[model samples]
Target chain A: MMNKKTAPVGVFDSGVGGLTVAREISRQLPDENIVYFGDTARVPYGSKSQNTIIRFSEQIIRFLKTKEVKAIVIACNTASALALDAVKDEFDIPILGVVIPGARAAVEATKNRKVGVVGTEATVQSGMYTKVIQGMNPEITVIEKACPLFVPLVEEGFKEHQVTEEVIEYYLESMRSTDIDAMILGCTHYPLLRSKIRAYMGDKIQIVNPAYETAMDLKCLLEENDMANDGTEGQHSNYSFYVSDAAEKFRKFANTVMPFDVPITNVVNIEGY
Target chain B: MMNKKTAPVGVFDSGVGGLTVAREISRQLPDENIVYFGDTARVPYGSKSQNTIIRFSEQIIRFLKTKEVKAIVIACNTASALALDAVKDEFDIPILGVVIPGARAAVEATKNRKVGVVGTEATVQSGMYTKVIQGMNPEITVIEKACPLFVPLVEEGFKEHQVTEEVIEYYLESMRSTDIDAMILGCTHYPLLRSKIRAYMGDKIQIVNPAYETAMDLKCLLEENDMANDGTEGQHSNYSFYVSDAAEKFRKFANTVMPFDVPITNVVNIEGY
Candidate 1:
């Protein structure tokens, strides 16, 4: 049996956008093994309903459990916002979602007590970010907007295109005019368009990426739980990727953004779980 | 028992985009009942692999078969390009895809023997349109480009927005410079952006909508098979809509673009099939 301390950490998202979170985890915890799953077959969960997102997250967690993961990270913001509460307790392992970490960071970064959040339709509709931020500090005001086109723009590989700049201006026109001192890139895909968004929002507004905060939180959770891999077991850290759809496209995208070369990717029929 | 002549025609798409085809069918075949299924849960099949697209298309077709549909229309361009051939002969009923009709219309409309096609990534990669057009006339040339962002732009309700026009210009710049006399709005959702596309392409090029061509083809098939509904049985023509995800969003979108009111929509677990 694999030692619980040496077992891999499981991370999942609706699709490849969660790679941003996975990359942060790899950077923060270099000694830990990571098993990542992307449900590329039914991606962009930001526009889906609460019930569907919850169901998908549960299935992914169940699949990760079969891999004997010590901890799990709900890397996709939409899933983190809508599904984490419903599935977090169903499993015994420490499970962390990006929403709380993101909210906390947004609260800390804001000087004007006003924060802006841009995410998918479902994430904004759930009001998860605003709820968590206000729950921490009632005086803080949260301005939420759903930028449904960002994921498609990133997925279409238009992150640096002129039209993407135009799209950013179009969606953030109202948010830019506000007094918010910090803005949260609420969707995992948005981080890929960070330069464009930052360019449009300017230097006055700080940008918060939940991927970084979620990785920090995961590190603390492992340390407190005594589950951190210490590199004494003669086990070398390894990274494995699995997606619900074709691995070629995912592998190509991952290689361009991932910290390490993604040579092999596995395909899993997620619907069966 | 439902009479063969009175059975509703089944039309299916990855999502609500197929409503364009459904509306066209209603206009051309006024006496016929219709069954429309949108796989909203696993939508935008444009970027997915051929095998996954085929599996999803099969599940949807099986679900529609339970509705006792006389014939099926693969209203989604991605599915029509990738999945139609694999599943068409598997079912006893006639299954028609939009690719052939769209390609035929482009061939007829183009006087310069050159045509342009725009669709989802899967549809363009499938080369179904190019193959069909070139097969009809070896001398003709087919220029294909995948406008993956168009679907999301339309879904985001940016049909009349200026950013859409910019995106249109970006995607069609090279095509506009070409001498292709006819351009096919190959994807079903594309009809919503017809005005923007027309304005960009200018008056020199003719635009072909596969929805209209597919509807005309269906009319011919029904007449040839003597399966046209004559309303002689006093069975009032009715339309029913079903989706794989939450019905509320689908109902709202359908109400906006559909010719008739979508009073009630049902949700189906498409994975169960």
Candidate 2:
């Protein structure tokens, strides 16, 4: 049996977007080995229904458990919003999602008592951030808008393109009129477009990235549970990547953005899980 | 077994984009019943690999066959380009893809011998259109560009929006510089942006929508194979709709654009196949 303290942390997303969260975890928990899965085959869960999202999430969790992970993180915003609650208790290990941590960070950053959220259609429709933020404090007013094209724009490598700036203007023009002091980059893919988003929204509006906060939450969780990996094993950590489809694409994209080099990527038929 | 002359035709796409093709079929063959399947759960097959696309196409074809249809039409251009050849021989029924018909039409429409093709990344990368067109006429020059954002724009109901026009400009600017007299709207969703595409490309450049040509080809296939549905049953043709997920959204989108009302839609777990 694998030691509970040294067992790898499993992280998953619908596609390569979740690498942002994985990178954060790697930065914060340098000694911990990581097993990351990207469901590139049935990706863009943002447009899918709640039932379907839940089903996909459950399948991924089941797959992750087989990796002997001590804990799991739902990195995709859509899956975190729609699937976390339903499957969190089904497994024995600790399960974390990106929504609450981001929501908490947004609540703390907002000086004007108003917070803005930009996410996928499913995440916005779920109103998970608003619910979580308001549940923490009822006084904060949450403004939510679904930027459906942001993910595609980011995935297509149009993060800083003029066309992407036009699209940002198209989606965020109305939101800019409000007095929100902080905006949460609710979708994992949003961080890739952070520069474009920041330029359009201006510096006054604090941009909160959940990946950072989620990593903090994860650190606290490990400390509280005594599941943190000690450095006695080794200084170098093992990071394995498994995607449902397009391993080469995932590797290429990861190498471009990730802090470390992803030398080998395995393709798993996630549907069977 | 169902009567060959009275059985419906199977039309399948990656998602609701194929409704354009289904609507065209309804107009061209008013008497034939149609069974349409939109893999809404695992859609936008454009970014996926050839093996994954082929696997998905096989699954959809198996599901459509269960509906007792006389023939099947691969309405999505990406799947047509990547999957059609692999799966065509496996099934006994006549299977038609949009690429050949569209290539033929583009070959005939381009008087200057310079033809433009716009599609998803996979379709353009496959170089299927260039190969088919050049094979048909050795002298024709094919210009292929992938407009990855068009589908998301159409799906987001931004068909006539200014942002879509900007994106259209972003993708088509280089193509416009060339002397191509005709452009193929290589993806099914592109037809929904016909007005904007036509406006930007100007009046002289002919826009060829493969949906219409594919429908005409379906008509010819039915007639050639003696599979045409006789009108003795009734004028009202039964059109059944199935999707992998989001049945309500499919019905709503279909009702808005389809020639006939889609009163009932069934959700099938296509992954089970």
Candidate 3:
């Protein structure tokens, strides 16, 4: 039997958008197995209410626990912002979310006190990032904007298209006006458009991706807690992907956004959990 | 108790975008009452599997029947394309979907027998428009392109912005190459960007707004079935809106898309049904 330390880590998101986070985690921790669940049935958590987001997160965590995961990562930014607080204590294992790590990294990177955030409307509206940044340093200023079109643009395979560039310029023009030195890519989908966003915002502005920071935090937590999969052999990792609806569509999208070819995805009835 | 004919019509979509269809319905049937449901929690039905959509539509219809609605209008194009057939026969009320009416209108209006369609990926993927048009006239040519960005662009309030114009041009440039005479606004949300879409496609190409055609069909159905509220007393019509997620966000969006001020919206737990 495999040791408990060799058990797979769990990652959950509202949809395929969070594969970016899962990708970053896999890149940093190649020895650890991963089981990813995407709630494609109730996606775009950014627009949903805090209560609904929390309830959905609880159900997903319950389902993930059944998979024998060692740790859980709230890969969906909205879930990280709104649901992580209520459910963190429900499980004995370490739980990490994208929001706190991202806020921390942004504070460390900003030369100037002013920082900018661009995410889905619900993430920005929750004021979670702003509160975290302000909690770390009382005087640090935060400007948050909801760039709703970024997710759809990424999903539409328009990451570097001219239309995408135009849309980026349109959403980020106001962020440029604040003279902020760093901008947090608050939504995971925004990282796919990093090149266009970087080009439009110029070199002076640092783009803080939460996926990278979240992965770093997970690495540190695993090492500190002695949960690292150090005894695992040289075999390549197998990533199990699951979605609540449309496995074929999820597989097709996973192919586009993932670093490697997406293997077969299983469609789970998450609502039944 | 309200008379059967005086009861409100129930219109439903995955989100507030369906208010465009509701607005059109109210325009054509000024005397009729309306009860609209926006399933903001599980929006963008375009990406979900057929089973999930059918299940969702059934839940919404069950809720609408409880509201004493005389008929049900699948104001969402995705729902119309995917779920209407599964539930239409199950209900005793006059059930109408936007797809068949839009397809019929496009077939009737096309002079060159070549028609184009622009909608969300799911609608285009369903090929409902192509099947209906070709079924009506086998000689006619049908071309469908999924303009995924249009809905988000409208939601971002970029309807008249230059960026929107650029995005529109980007998506429709391929359609421009074809000798199509008319284009179907396959998604209900597309009507909000009607002016920009029309300007880009030019007057020689007719842009068929399914919302308008859907309203016309509803008007004809009401009159033919003697369900019209003709003998009702002189009182302002009431519009009741419901959402499965954030009511405030739905209200804000409803104000932008609908011509009149939005009424109070009740946030329902749609999963309960």
Candidate lDDT values, in order: 0.91, 0.92, 0.88
- What DockQ would you assign to candidate 2? 0.84
Q: Candidate 3: where are CA atoms >4 Å away?
A: A1-3, A89-92, A223-226, A232-237, A256-261, B1-3, B223-226, B233-236, B256-261
Model 2 quality (TM-score): 0.98
Candidate 1 residue-wise lDDT, A1-273, digit = tens: 768788999999999988899899989998899999999999879878898998888889989989999999999999999988888778777899999999999999999899999999999999999999999999999999999998898887787888888888888999999999999999988888888888889999999999999999999999998999988977768999999998988999999889779969999989988
Candidate 2 stretches greater than 4 Å from native: none
Give the worst 10-residue stretch by lDDT in candidate 3 chain B. Answer: B226-235
Per-candidate TM-scores read: 0.98, 0.98, 0.92
Model 1 stretches with alpha carbons more than 4 Å out: none
Candidate 1 per-residue C-alpha lDDT over B36-100 given as tens digits, one digit per residue, 9 for 90 to 100: 99999988798899999999988989999999998999999999999899998788888999999
> Tens digit of lDDT per residue, candidate 3, span A18-103?
89899999899888889999999988888778999988998899898888888999998989999898998777778999999999
Q: What 10-residue stretch in candidate 2 chain A is worst by lDDT?
A: A229-238
Candidate 3 per-residue lDDT over residues B11-96, each given as its tens digit? 99999878889988888888888999999889878777788999899999999999999889999999999888899888888899
Candidate 2 positional error at B14, Å? 0.5
Candidate 2 docking band:
high
User: Per-residue lDDT for A4-93 in model 2, tens only?
Assistant: 878899999999999999999989989889999999999999999999999999889889999999999999999999989998877788
Clashing pairs in 1: none
